[model samples]
Target chain A: MAKVGLFLGCITPLRYPGIESSTIDVLEALGVEAKILQGTSCCPAPGVFRSFDQEVWRALGARNLALAEEQGVEILNICNGCFGSLSESSHQLREDPKKLEKVNNILSQIGKKYNGTAKVRHFAEFLYRDVGLENIAKRVKNKQDHLKVAVHYGCHFLKPRMLKEIDDPERPKILDELVEVTGAKSIPYKDKQMCCGAGGGVRARTKDVAQKMTIQKMENINEVGANVIVDVCPFCHLQFDQGQEEVETKVPVLHLSQLYVLAFGLPKERMGVEAHAIPVNF
Target chain B: MSEEGEPKLVNPEFTKEVIKRGADTITLCFQCATCTGGCPSGRITAFRTRKLMRRVQLGFKEDVLPSDELWLCTTCMTCDERCPRGVKITDIIMTLRNMAVEEGHMAEAHKRTAGMLIKTGHAIPMGDKFRELRKTLKLDEVPPTVLCDPKLYEDVVKIMKATEFDKLIGERIDG
Candidate 1:
């Protein structure tokens, strides 16, 4: 079994621990070792904190990468935002010697150094690639054919297509293909590639604006009659799950991992269903 | 709102400064509105991605920085992905935001989040509610992270200090 460190960015462990637990359970069931990366901080959240200071952003991100290097494992990021920040930081550190030197100067103070050897893999991409769709299809103990999921390919996971070669950012089929493997229908929705409006510090700084965007997305999903909103990112998970209350719309939201957990015949208790503001009932 | 006010001088230095910081694509924008048209935040907010790029190109630092419009972007990167000119619109916005912060133009909510990082090493710290939830899921009450280890948390604080994150975010006050 291949062992990898799980990079659980803030919102997953702090706001939705269920996503973290479900990811571990699903990965373990898939015969992969999922160890939580210790001493990791926020991906520093690219849009919020990274916008404030580049040096600090790179330093902290490199610090997290360094921790993974210590454990002798590649990072398995559970959140899109974490994957974006760490992946971008790794690319920058590898490409720019000056940046690596400056970030190393900061890390030296804390007895850490980012050798740029750390690798990050998004959980969804890992499932589609390493785990193989056919293998996932075989593991489906409880197929959820009744689920009409509005798949949300959150911004960072696929956008800036030059950097993230995961899929076609505008017309992605990776998530849809992955969803089908579990016997769930990846229903088409209006503006399916649109963002959930919880990113870029908008939700944190301007609630009304973020709420408006979330409402717009919810309306689109509602129009398509998607029974559930399935996303790969925890922040997007929070936006859809909790943002439903503000928009006065109730569509049970599930992180992709939880969707798999349900398909794996895991008990609902393991998913922390009660933690969601929108009740996730089958 | 004064139409008769003297026209602001275009500071070429500001444009050069942003370009130097790695948003060289700021100059590649040819005033095409592809970025604005695809922007989701622009649809609901006063943010205009095209105009912001234009302002940056013209070195209108005063117009671009210190404006609440800067905070409205969701950083969704839709504009960046759709630009025909291949301009890195989202990256330029981020670079502009970094400059905005240097000018002390951070939003209050962002500052509060920054403070949280300073105190807990995680912007969104684990609340008591999640602690109970984790326990029910048969997981560790506190997921092994900077939050559970003192040495790791100390390293986080030291990095924050080394990078002047604590200084930029200011001191955090207890709730």
Candidate 2:
């Protein structure tokens, strides 16, 4: 059993409640003894500062991390964006001498510091590393059968080439491995490493561009002949799921969290499947 | 010729501002088309991600703004992650979107979606059917994370306060 700060990203909170709820369910089902940490905020993703104001992005991100540190718990992120930003910022705080000084200065004002403390774990990583796939398989009351899923790692969870976390940057298998625990087959695609085009406010920015990116992602999914795309981030799920029409393809999207919930025999309704852009048959 | 000439852009000022604010990652874009290829939203419409970045590089705000292309993006952050040049493509797109909404020029669907998101905290708009289904399944109602945790509300409130996101949507009743 491990203590955790459930770092639900912006999308999971407002868009994909199912993922958040299911993550809690899966973790609890695993008997890991998890608890949601209080006082969480936007990861202040590189989406904000690295593009507009690195200073604010860092300051704000440090603020989020500080809360996790203050609580004395490891950070478990559900969103790829938060995973990327938090991991990178944590890297900066630990390795980058200059960034640490600058971010620390801002922290002084907030009376907080990143402090090189606490490990940031994506929910999938948490299951693989902390709980182990075999351990999770033991708890699966219902394992999905004949379900084919295409895993979308998204970009933030795998890239920037420096976070150095998870498996392969282009072909990560943590999601696939976890899907196996639920008795689901994870498929591959041409654009498996492609971005969902939901970052940078693309969904809110303009539908045209959003659709363009969606189409490409869908093309990849279409080629794989998978019924669903299993993912971790809610934003990615939104971009691929709700944005699937925008993807110009009609494959359903499922968060790895939802799969876990279903594997525990949670009904589709309990997992928020109907709310998805493409309704899940099961 | 590509390196020697000015890249196409929608808003040079917006691009300049983005770059000046440490978004020089936009400057590293060499038009390798990785972002365009990797972009999930770029496959729709005529608005190519590469072209959008080009427009940003050239700082053509007039061209970039007021286009359905800008709002089309879902901001999944793929381009930024794959850019060998490390271009902050998502950042550029977000700034442009924020600017669009600030000016009250966003698409009606976008506004309605935002409204729905604000009101229900859920992207898809569904009525009592799902709620009743929740009851039938005996599913734990969507645990109001906000209601369950006031502290999160406070933190978000502060971040929004500092970012002035609310001010940007003045007099706009979010559905």
Candidate 3:
């Protein structure tokens, strides 16, 4: 129930509005005041700079951080990619004064300066921490008793631990806990820790690589007989949901927001269910 | 192995944002070749992410952009996750791909695909053949939201403008 800025990266807002609609529903139901960050861009992601120039990565990411800082609020990210890139980059700037100064110098040209002033949080962390799982379950007027869900922890949020304050890095429990709030069963599955093929912008630049990884994740989820896979990151959600068709997988994928909307008994249209590639019958 | 000031010639048009957007991840990589080692295309050939990163960081734009190896990356994100430094291998590749498009350096096959994506939102055209497949599977479908909306490009551009990516790119292109 805290006021925060909602950061939806390049793909989520217009491309996947269902995810946004559902995310908003859950947060508002909990009495949280979420304002969308108007000036945010691509996380500008680490891969771009880590490949092109070391210094520029810090600057672009810091610029993103500075924009959130402009609002003077902790920014909760809907995409795991954005959360991972922003939080990790913020940590880097705060930890290294020299690097921070160089990044700030670049930002000054854009009229922005980041001293790593705000906190970057993923929705999973916000849900379990701020709203509390017990509180979320209390509002579940309609329960999805038949929906068997697989909780996918996106790699960026799951990796290089200590940054993800919500769930344990290895064997994450928070996402599973959120699924339970809908009265859905969160299945235990193998390769549950695997990365989505879409992250790091692979789905955009490289199709074969992205599709192959999607196939691997698809096979893993199928192996467990999960009816649907639930996830936090837009990158991950797109991969398993729509990207599954890049190969020939049938199991549907759901962003956590999408799934939660269903459990909340909202209209399927509002959940943007029609937009999904793998149709969610539930 | 090279000496400094041998005339450090970065392409002037490649702004800090351009470089940052595309290949900034070069520094986060080491020469482990894990990216290449696990690369789906590397199974058939010897494409290596480490080598690609090395070239990009060195500003070997031509080498990085048009390489058949660069086109072969599948973007599994495994390497991005595996990197001990957590460098994003896929986004780096995307940046290089985007630069190739902007510079008209894209290979014949690559340019055609980008054109297809711009027009269809998919890399391949769906003439009658795909419709037949959809009918066969009973997989009735409509254009994805990102594609169905006539104004998707304008909306995306607006978001980019919101983030000032437009301004960043404009500055470099105008100059």
Report the CAPRI category for model 3: incorrect
lDDT of 1 by residue, A1-282 (tens): 346899988998888888988998899888887788887889879888878888889999999999999998889988989988998888889999999999999899888888888878899999888889888888899989999999998998987788878898988999999888888999898888988999999999998888888899999888888889889999999988878776555789999899999898876778888889888887
Tell me the tens digit of each residue's lDDT in model 2 across B1-175. Answer: 1243776434456777867644577788888898778655546556588988777788777677667677555455556667878776765665665565555665555455444323332234444554454444454343334334655545444443344433443334442
Q: Score the docking of each candidate (DockQ).
A: 0.83, 0.21, 0.10
Worst 10 residues of 3 chain A by lDDT: A47-56
Residues B75-124 of candidate 1 have per-residue lDDT tens digits of 89989888989998877888899888877888778888888888898988
**i-RMS for every candidate:** 1.0, 5.7, 8.9
Per-residue accuracy of model 3 over A1-282 as CA lDDT, tens digit each: 567888766456535556766777777777888876655545644433233233444565676678778887778888876777787678878988988887776666556778677888888888888888888887787898787787888776656555555555656787888898898899887767766666433455566676776687777777877788888877677777767665445777788887777776765665766656778787
Better candidate by TM-score, 1 or 3? 1
Docking class of 1: high
Model 3, position A167: C-alpha lDDT score: 51
Query: Which prediction has the highest lDDT against the true structure?
Result: 1
Q: Where does model 2 exceed 4 Å of error?
A: A13-15, A44-60, A88-118, A244-250, A266-269, B1-20, B23-175
Model 3 spans > 4 angstroms off: A48-50, A246-249, B1-175
Better of 1 and 3 by DockQ: 1
